[model samples]
Target: MSGEPEVHEEFEARLKTYEGRPAAETGVGRDPVNEPMIRHWCEAMGDTNPAYTGPDAIAPPTMLQAWTMAGLTGRPERAAAYDELLRLLDESGHHAVVATDCEQEYLRPLRPGDAITFDSVIESVSERKTTKLGTGYFVTTRTDVRAGGELAGTHRFRILKYAPARRPRPAPARRPGQPGERRPRPVVNRDNAGFWEGVTRHELLIQRCTDCHTLRFPWLPGCNSCGSAQWDTVAASGEGTVCSYVVMHYPPFPAFDPPYAVGLIELAEGVRIVSNVVGVPYDKVRIGMPVRLEFRRYDEELVLPVFRRYDEELVLPVFEGVPE
Candidate 1:
């Protein structure tokens, strides 16, 4: 594939129309606090608080004016970023790009009489990769919602763009008569016990801080998000991109081999985690590779998500400016 990005006119047209625009100014938008929208939000969140449904319903902190907006389809411009990424991947032939992680922050609650505007930007893009099947790209979009000109919320959306494999690369081969590297067993704690158990089931788990309502990782006894002692374990989608990573040249553990890549992956569940990356050669690994969660079974009750190099077969001209 060429290094030059093949800009789709249809995608650009949609982006130009939606960028820096207000929904109200465009018409055909719903009021966030309107009865129907509010009820829908309440039901969607399974929140039964009278404050939201009562005559004097105080809007929930999680509510945003953008929540009232309906999903789009007819408007080719709607989801312009996602469509653009998909088109890029399809053109390249890596089709396995998938949603892995998202992080949202509620700046303020949606209230009656608030007119909201939404603006989105293509925050970042990653280098093209050669996966087993084809080439792929990882794209991130940041969408901001403003109520009455004040920041109401922010959504960080990520997608994988894949295309058919043009130059199929061989998968990593295990050394003959050599066992795979081993990772030390981690002792379960009260806070992380559930998380470890979930991993065995090939599921990701995060602790929700009751006090601050923030999601905490690494399974702390107290809420790392809010310092609250009360917490709950929530299941997470075991998909994410490599937020940061490193290839260790030195062997500190007997079970680990030299030149293995360790990465901190940002999951779609809004949590970041550290794990080993496999399935691709060490030299090809880079930040933001579009990886699917693969569970490695250890013994009877242990499983963990190990990232494999994605899109290892499609060929693309070398790209610059992506995270290493």
Candidate 2:
């Protein structure tokens, strides 16, 4: 038998030994189901369903795993076998891990004051396989959650512990006067074509429903409030404040610089728009800081509206924000 193939088979056999073993057992939720967590979850998700509020409020069904979270210190009941299995994969060069997907099934609703317990098992470990993210095996865990010893839900989570694939950098565009590399073009269809056109003319136009006199951003085909298809344009006052922002630093792309700030700006018109916040460092972008509109031309074919801090001196037009 070939030595390398024999080694591979032995490794696979070792991994299979962990399948169906307990990943976590006798895991008790740190907090009982309550309104404060429910309220926080609803607000973060922008969910306003009345069923989640008032005295009769039940926790969101998807919060099944939330109750079982180990937090920074992790759960005491977590088995060492699961950690050992992951260590083996990391030793085999599958050191990077990203959650691929999850599935949940709810059997009963959980209400305030319900104490939760869960047991998780290592459901399966796939044979070594190659993916766009590089070669790795899929690890799936299933957690059975219970309330007062009654089955409440099952959550299945899958992750890819992979070695990232190397990608060749795209060559710079050869055209004279063109930017080094082209940014991805915005998807402009009939619904949002006017928005792109307005950008080309150096205007940030918000859509207003002619029927109900409601203003909306991103050029929705119909009014969300009144369901009116008839709409007109209103020029943005070019003033806004950062409502929320994120600094991206992973899975680097060729057309972008890392550690950039992408802000959800609350416009003076009462609508919110997401664009890059420039002038200040990414880490310095704070909610409630004022920003002003600016148009940046990537190439002859691409022009986008971005926001700069209202306090910074205007710098020459450059690609400094998230792609629209």
Candidate 3:
């Protein structure tokens, strides 16, 4: 998803305040995922294990990844805000951003009934040298997933926000049914160009780390899990549910006006990605909503993979039962 320059500037300003504040400690809150959520995730991933759906449910290992990133539960709390300098750094327009890389370490298993809290901090921020177009910064946020005040897991998210090639236009008036600008696009390069190329084809491709046999998205030369350098490209089914989402209004991208919805979509193959929900109103794009892949052309070599809603009104499981 993208944001306008002004709103981008404002966000950067606020982030600066968060820089030295120390990752805001989150209080114990109710489990964001309830029974329905659990069922949806299990079904979305085609995971029918009794443990996840049974009365005594043990959460899936990846469930904590979703739970912690949902941000603080209940009302908006300042406990997680970043410093001012960081905020200013975020002002540059960016879209359809992905976590090009991430590292998560699980210390304990999470059961369905466990009440967990994620105490997250802005781990670090580093600037990238300017290439042909514009420049950007990489921000890493580390969150400690805690269950009943005990350590359960730790997540390190590396996100890149870059300046847009074209300047954004003025944001339009709010409309009830539309989506605004999207988030920043993950930085693409020669090594991972094939992955982005797949997006242009409306296909999801993962690089299987040849040495470790791990499926890697957003393309990486070395395995984030095992540090293996060999990798092979494989096609994936571009289908999954909304793991989480955000409705951006403050900063609108020129390509998209206010307000649009950007989501953390977990693909059927188990790779979680960031994109927008199309062919449906933003208000209706709820968590757990099923979506299918669609290709978007951004210039010549660049194609973006976005999602469109699938429901009774629109058939879901679009890629399911289809031949591989």
CA-lDDT, candidates in order: 0.62, 0.85, 0.65
Better of 1 and 3 by TM-score: 3
Candidate 2 is scored at a TM of 0.50
Say which prediction, candidate 1 or candidate 2, comes out ahead on lDDT. 2
* Strongest candidate by TM-score: 2
Kindly report which residue stretches of model 1 are placed more than 4 angstroms away from their true locations once superposed.
1-182, 299-302, 311-324
Judged by whole-model lDDT over C-alpha atoms, candidate 3 comes out at: 0.65
User: lDDT for model 2, on a 0 to 1 scale?
Assistant: 0.85
For each candidate, give its TM-score against the true structure: 0.39, 0.50, 0.41
Model 2 poorest 10 in a row by lDDT? 167-176
lDDT tens readout by residue for model 1, 1-324? 323454444443443443333222222234445667777778988988887875666567556424534565343224544455556456444455676557788887767666766666666655555555445555666767777777778877666665543322223663322344345668988767788778777777788887788887878888655567998777776667889888764323444444567888888777888988776665567888866677876534446768765564647623322221
Query: How many collisions per candidate?
Result: 18, 0, 35
Candidate 3: C-alpha RMSD after superposition: 25.3
Select the stronger candidate by TM-score from 2 and 3: 2
